[model samples]
Target: MGHVTFFGVVTFVFRHSAGCTGNAISSPHRCILVPSFEIKGKNSMPKMYRTKLAAMVKNFPRYASANQPPNGEIRSYIESAGHTCELRDAGEFQSPADVVNLVSEHPKFEAALAIHLFKAGRLLMDIEIPFGVIFGGTDINEDVKVEQKRVVMEQVLLKARFAVAFTDKLKEEAELFLVSQSSKIYVQPQGIQTDVTEKFCWTEFLRSSGVRTEHVDELRVFLLVCGLRRVKDPLYLVEVFSKWHCENLLNVLVIIGPKIDPVLTAEVETVVKRTAGVFLAQERCQQELHAAMKRCFAVVNSSVSEGMSAAILEAMDLGVPVLARNIPGNAAVVQHEVTGLLYSSPQEFVRQSQRLLSDHELRERVVRNGKLYVEEHHGVKQERETYQRLVDTLH
Candidate 1:
């Protein structure tokens, strides 16, 4: 066994007779770590039979990072159960047969998990492996609305050993489309860990991201964290945010996430170039991003849909106020005026954001309640236990 550290992250590597066993620790960047374990049986030291676990994650640079929460958290929980998991990029394969062919070359896997129902799950349908699908934000909120995507997702759900939804609202929405497998759908909110490092420097982040130094002293930052994609609607508030910025010159909306969609990324770049008080910061490690969120007046979410946002939960855990779009996925967690503020349109967002920034009492009340909500509902221990039980069913 040996270890390697990269990008300030440490990973353990262990060699096995069959090959190396590992799982990625998401964050600044992916760091694969292999755990040491021994398979057990009754009397004698039984021949070790490692429980091969395969995970297919969303194909995006951010998803590949150690700070993304979902994949890394799941991998950690699976490993804690004494299983060996290898996470692969689902986008690398062409079809279900391709996935099967790749897995066939490895040790017979006991179970497999795919990140998104409509994306990765559909590709794993015909694979000769017992697998489960986890509904991403788009799977329930966007993909299910498209007839073709919905049909394929329902088929995948039917073939799936089980399906996981991050929230009960999401489970209910999915059931409306996949009624037959409603019994197998489980609700497990994404576990969150806000581990912000003290090394984070807000001034340096602003300087590197092209934020104007002249306005730094009076800047009131609202961090909008989302990958640049159509579904995420990263630029939904760009025009209005810029207009408001011109009016006050105090508020700035800093968008941060990976470039998942090139066309959208280009559009965002164009908008940021012209829009005053609106900046696009490169994606930071989870800890650094959360630390930045803490520095901001509030965290914003402008997604068209969500499957329980780990970002929102992380902001709440960090005691940062949340301002999210009024979608079911966001609503399920943000109880308007309670845990966080929810808005339906750009104008509503502006109005609510102003209130959050001006009303000290409102901000304090909501931030306090949001932290409590996460502690009471999204406890990491509870999420770990629930996933462990789900993995047990695979046996």
Candidate 2:
């Protein structure tokens, strides 16, 4: 054994000749403190393995940061499981060679995990690294509809060592693209950590947004949290609310999400201006957002598509019933009238909203069931264990 130094929890090889067998030691916590190495020759270069992670969207920090999304969640899980991992920005890499250069430089990285297959599949082929892929919404829903994206996605799926999806529906969809290795498909839902506070600061948020707390006292408010993008359909409910706005009804729709697409943001603003009682607001911090979810009568998701929506799960975790679109992703979590109500069109959405708003018993029952649904199915511990089992097989 050669002299070793601690870098972090994991071990690293240092100043060793090439072609030497290195001993990598990991603690029970999966922290690598010192790496083992064998020297081949003074001229031989050290081998390094790098894991590259990618997401198509840029504003993830606004909502997810280090706390949300299974991507960040799995990164933490893998790190705690005793692997030296690095999160590479696949968005920053301009070309295939750039990605190849980045991944090829890292030593001891035997495989890489891509959050979405489309982003990682081709890159893995270019670099010739064993890659595991996870499916996102569009990959199975919209992208597969198009011949080009579908063909590319199929190639990626065929090349992947294993593929993960957020729902069983997605796993079945993956079977269509991955004709050869259907057994490699796995279903892993996104996990959320709930926040509980006796005091909620809705008054402060309303004040900052230029709405008087006095006005809030008399009105029924509903909160919609999602990025302003085509997939999310942020303006759908705003359009529906325009017809129902009445002084006697005294209801307001507050849409709060990061402005992702400029065109979509402009369209949302147009709807907000045209629709009375519809307020378009910027994104809120997790604490504030959770508080809003707690205070609101119901949380809504008008997404045209999704892969196990985190927003729906979060709302459910907070004992808030959901009003979601009747899509595969929404149906996977919400049991129609059992946990939440689902609608097909804007008119149906209004009808469902009317029923939930007028009936207190229905609302309370759904809220109770929604919370139970999240606790049983989408807990953070359950998500972590699933990934641990998958990675344990790899080791």
Output the number of the TM-score-best candidate: 1
Candidate 2 deviant stretches above 4 angstroms: 1-21, 27-59, 62-68, 106-108, 177-180, 196-200, 210-213, 247-249, 393-395
What is the C-alpha lDDT profile of model 2 across 1-395, one tens digit per residue? 11111111111111112222344331121111110110000111111211122222222332422112444455555554444444444444455575455544423333455555554444455655455566656667777777786777787777766677888888887677545567888888877776656566777665554444467767677777787778888887776676776543567778877776788889888767766778876666666678887887778888888877787888888988899999888898889888999999988988888889789999988899988888887878777776545544332
Per-residue lDDT of model 1, residues 121-182, tens digit only: 77666656566667766777777788998999888788877777788877888888765677
* Per-structure clash totals for the candidates: 6, 23
TM-score of each: 0.86, 0.82
All-Cα superposition RMSD per candidate: 7.5, 8.6
Global Cα lDDT for candidate 2: 0.59
The most accurate candidate by lDDT is 1
